[model samples]
Target: MIFEFLLLVAIILAIAAVEVKDMLYAVLILGGLDLVVAVLFYLMAAPDIAITQIVVTAVFGTFIYVVAVNRTGRKEVIE
Candidate 1:
């Protein structure tokens, strides 16, 4: 049940990342989604993958995205 709930949360986060207007918010949502996925991986008996996911995706990826957003601005410029 908990795993299923995490999956649902991940799905919701993904959708939110897509729907959100702010690039920063989307990056944060993706970080959350990655965390949830890491939990799911841990629950599935893949501790290594889970740790990698948290370290690589949740941490570094978010940092990179945040930096990019900061440089590029939060909102998309429609041409």
Candidate 2:
């Protein structure tokens, strides 16, 4: 039940992340959704993949987001 809930939440977050107009918000949501997926992987007993995903999504992904944000200011409103 909890696993299903987590998966549902992850899916919803992933969809929202993609649909969001704000790039920064979308990146943040993507990272969050990725973390959720990693947790789900862990719950499913895939520790190696979970750890890799967690590290890549939380660390590397955030770094990429920061670089992108720095390259392009976040003040631009997206419609």
Candidate 3:
């Protein structure tokens, strides 16, 4: 049941990350998704992989995205 809940949350976060208009919000949502995936990995008995996922993806990935968005702007350019 917990696994299912995390999966659902991850799916929702993925969709929200894509749908959000602001780049910062999207990056935050993607970070949340990464965290959820890490938790799923932990539950699946892959602690090493889960730790790597949290450190590499959730932390570094989000930092890179935030830096890129900061260099650019938060608003999406639809033109």
- The candidate that wins on lDDT is 3
Runs in model 1 with CA error above 4 Å? none
Q: In terms of TM-score, how similar is model 1 to the real structure?
A: 0.93
Top candidate, metric TM-score: 3
For model 3, residues 14-51, the per-residue Cα lDDT tens digits are 99999999899899999989999999999999999999
Candidate 3, TM-score vs. the true structure? 0.96
By TM-score, the better pick of 1 and 3 is: 3
**Error of model 3, residue 33, in angstroms:** 0.6
Cα lDDT tens digits for candidate 2, 11-79: 999899878877788888888988998999999999999999999888898889979987997655658
By TM-score: ranked, best first: 3, 1, 2
Q: How accurate locally is residue 17 in candidate 2, as Cα lDDT from 0 to 100?
A: 80
Residue 66, candidate 2: alpha-carbon lDDT: 74
Report, for every candidate in turn, its global Cα lDDT versus the true structure.
0.94, 0.88, 0.95
TM-scores of the models, in the order given: 0.93, 0.83, 0.96
Clashes of 2: 0
In model 3, where is the ten-residue run with the lowest total lDDT?
Answer: 22-31
lDDT of 1: 0.94
